[model samples]
Target: PLGQLPVLEIDGGKFPQSLAIARYLARQLKLGGKNDLESLKCDVIVDTMQEL
Candidate 1:
């Protein structure tokens, strides 16, 4: 409902922004990266792909 793109819903609350939502879920699930540097690299790749 918040625009045409998909959003994250939690406890009946709707959250916009795909990237932020994804990052939050990744962190919660411990799937972001094993280290900070790895996390940074993952973020870069995800962001780059999002831009394309």
Candidate 2:
């Protein structure tokens, strides 16, 4: 299983990383950053969360 959990599936496509999966869902669901600044903020959170 590659030792991973909470895999994301969209349109039959699989994504393993939580941040990438979250970003994809956010964009598709109209909850993602609408500009560069917001995108940067989201990225920062993603990075910090990965360290936890």
Candidate 3:
């Protein structure tokens, strides 16, 4: 069974783009926003950071 190991968890996976990963995590955590306006603000901050 060593050759066919089960995927118990994903420890370290590389993200092609940091921004995309950040956005995904934000959404998963519900840290992005509860409504349209807050979501827009979260997106703007992400964009600003990416610009830098």
Best by lDDT: 1
Q: Please, what are the lDDT tens digits per residue for candidate 2 over residues 1-52?
A: 3557768866796668787787888788877688989888887887899899
What's the candidate order when arranged by decreasing lDDT?
Answer: 1, 2, 3
Candidate 3 on 1-52: residue-level lDDT in tens? 1333222223574445556767778898999999999999999999999899
Please report, as a residue range, the 10-residue window in candidate 3 with the lowest summed lDDT.
1-10
- Residue-level lDDT of model 1, residues 1-52, one tens digit each, is 6584668888998888878877898899998999999899879977987899
Output the lDDT of residue 6, model 2. Answer: 69
Question: Can you give the lDDT of residue 42 in candidate 1?
Answer: 77
Question: What TM-score goes with each of the models?
Answer: 0.81, 0.72, 0.68
lDDT, candidate 1, at 26: 83
Model 2 C-alpha RMSD vs. true structure (Å) is 1.8
CA deviation > 4 Å runs, candidate 1? none
User: Can you give the lDDT of residue 33 in candidate 2?
Assistant: 88
Model 1 misses residue 47 by how many Å?
0.5
**Rank by TM-score, descending?**
1, 2, 3
- Report lDDT (Cα) of residue 48, candidate 1: 86
Error of 3 at 12 (Å): 8.9
